[model samples]
Target: MNKQEYMNCAEEELLHTYNRFPVVLERGEGVYLYDTDGKKYLDFAAGIAVSAFGYGKKEYNDALKAQIDKVIHTSNLYYNTPVIEAAKKALAASGMDRIFFTNSGTEAIEGAMKAAKKYAYTRDGHAGHEIIAMNHAFHGRSLGALSITGTRHYQEPFEPLIPGVRFAEYNDLDSVKKQITEKTCAIFLETVQGEGGIYPAEKEFIEGIRKICDEHDILMVTDEIQCGMGRTGKMFAWQHYDVKPDIMTCAKAFGCGVPVGAFLMTEKAAEKSLVPGDHGTTYGGNPLVGAAVSTVFDLMEKENILEHVQEVAPYLEHALDALVEKYEFVSARRGLGLMQGLVLNVPVGKAAAKALEEGLIIITAGSDVLRFVPPLIIEKSHVDEMAEKLDKVFAQIEA
Candidate 1:
């Protein structure tokens, strides 16, 4: 059917949870998506940083197909080979001791929260189960993750959230220190705050947090759902800081196009999380998602995915920088790899709509900051074309 018909049907039948755009994408390939009417748009957002493998890759498709033929799922009761392999790769990639898989990024954050608080509460008693999160952070919409996301715009509507979540100013270690009292159980942060306008944590800031965590005995948890999995030119963004977290939550791009999530932790936290079924998910480690995840690692290593991100992402960043330098409307440019941003001096919602009208898909982070999370496979030529289009678009914005 046509785009209008599809949207009308969805509006009538589907849940009104999302405020969707007008375009109804029918298919995607590489870094482009085609609407039902065959109109193509440069997929700059890359499904909100979830389509790391790009639109359709043969390896991912083949792996998923093979799994579909064999067995889609088996409960957590039985051992699933693909799930076991996925856990192995994920643990090795994170350099963490254990993992608990889930169904989405928020679920991963929820699991991370539980693991962090439990790690502290059981060890030092319940009174110390407080978490310190950054200002303007965006973890997820779940109750627990929502409680830690420092943006009140998202949390104000859903009040009466979990307590003990202290908001520290982003990139300010002094603020963090002031908030981290004896009751603090963890310091949870995004390695690069994706929804906080793509702000990367200062190296010194992260080091200070690590030091504080050590001194105060608080777990340091970094949410890498949007920044990890080669989105930041590294396997994990925390690696760039020369520091590791006590716990890490990763999802979004982990299963390629499929739905999955995982929260990993150090050996210390993993050992204590065992309360004889304290936490579990029906599809946590489902073999089908594991199959897709297993192939992701194979592709990551074989294709030198991180190397490609390093090589190509510079072009993407340079493109955005060129626009920022040329246009006064762009206030700032930040973020690593393809997870870059163009901080518009004005509200980005209109600019994003204009972008979609111009056959490009982009997303806004915090207010005026426009996020660009293109597919990992995007090349230099794609970068040049996108930059030119964006330059032309911004020029029209002034007119």
Candidate 2:
């Protein structure tokens, strides 16, 4: 169907939750997407960092097809081969001892919050199990996740939210220290903030948090939903700081486009919190999604995706720096590895719309930042193409 047909069906049948772009993408190959009318677009957004291995990887496709022929899903009441295998791989890579899979990053955040609260209650009492989250941090949209999310605009309408949650300034060690109370259960943060504008946590700040958490016996929860799974040239973003979180949440590229997420805990928290009946999900960790997770991890290792990111990230960063140098409206660049954003003098939505019209698919974050989270498999040539297209978009903005 054409774009109009697709839009018509969506308008009639679907809830208008998102202000979606007009183009109807029909297919994707490598780093390019094609609309039904045969227009091509360089896909820098990568489905908001979901398609890490790019579109239609053969090994990934084969793994899913084989699993489909065998078994897609089985009740968690029974053991399944795919889940067991995937769990092992995930735990091994993440350095976490226990795992609970969920259907989305928001669900992972929910599970992590539950576990943290339960752990705190188990130790002290059920009286005051509060959480400390960073300001401008974007967790997820569920009530539990949304409560902890730092953006006030998103949370104002959903008030009287999960009580006892407080927000602290990102990368501010002193601010975090000031917010801590005896009631604090967990200190949640994104090692590299994503939707709040691609700000990577300062190493000293993370270290300070680790020290404080250790001192107070508070659980440290890091949300790697956007910056994990080799996006930052590391299996996990926390690895970059040389500090491990007591609990870690990951999704997005976890299944390389499949809707799967998980929260894993250290052995200590695993022993104390979320004992069986405390938390559960029906469709999480099923064989079908497990296959996707397992395949993504396997391909990342076999293809040396981390090394590739290490090599190409510098080039992408340099190109973005060049853009900053050339364009008056481009004020700053932030992020690490493939997850980067350009702070703009104009509204990010306007620049993004113009880029889309110029055959480039880009996205906005934090209202005034244009985020570039391309697939992990993107090469220098693709980066060049992106730069060229962005140049045109910038020129249009200047005019």
> What lDDT does each candidate get?
0.88, 0.93
**Predicted candidate 1 versus true structure: per-residue lDDT over 121-178, tens digit per residue:** 6787564468999999999998888999999889999999998889999899999988
Question: Which regions of candidate 1 deviate over 4 angstroms?
Answer: none
What digit string (tens of lDDT, one per residue) describes model 2 on residues 292-321? 998888999999999999999999999999
Residue 353 lDDT, candidate 1, scale 0-100: 87
* Residue pairs whose backbone atoms clash in candidate 2: none
Which residue runs does candidate 2 get wrong by more than 4 Å? none
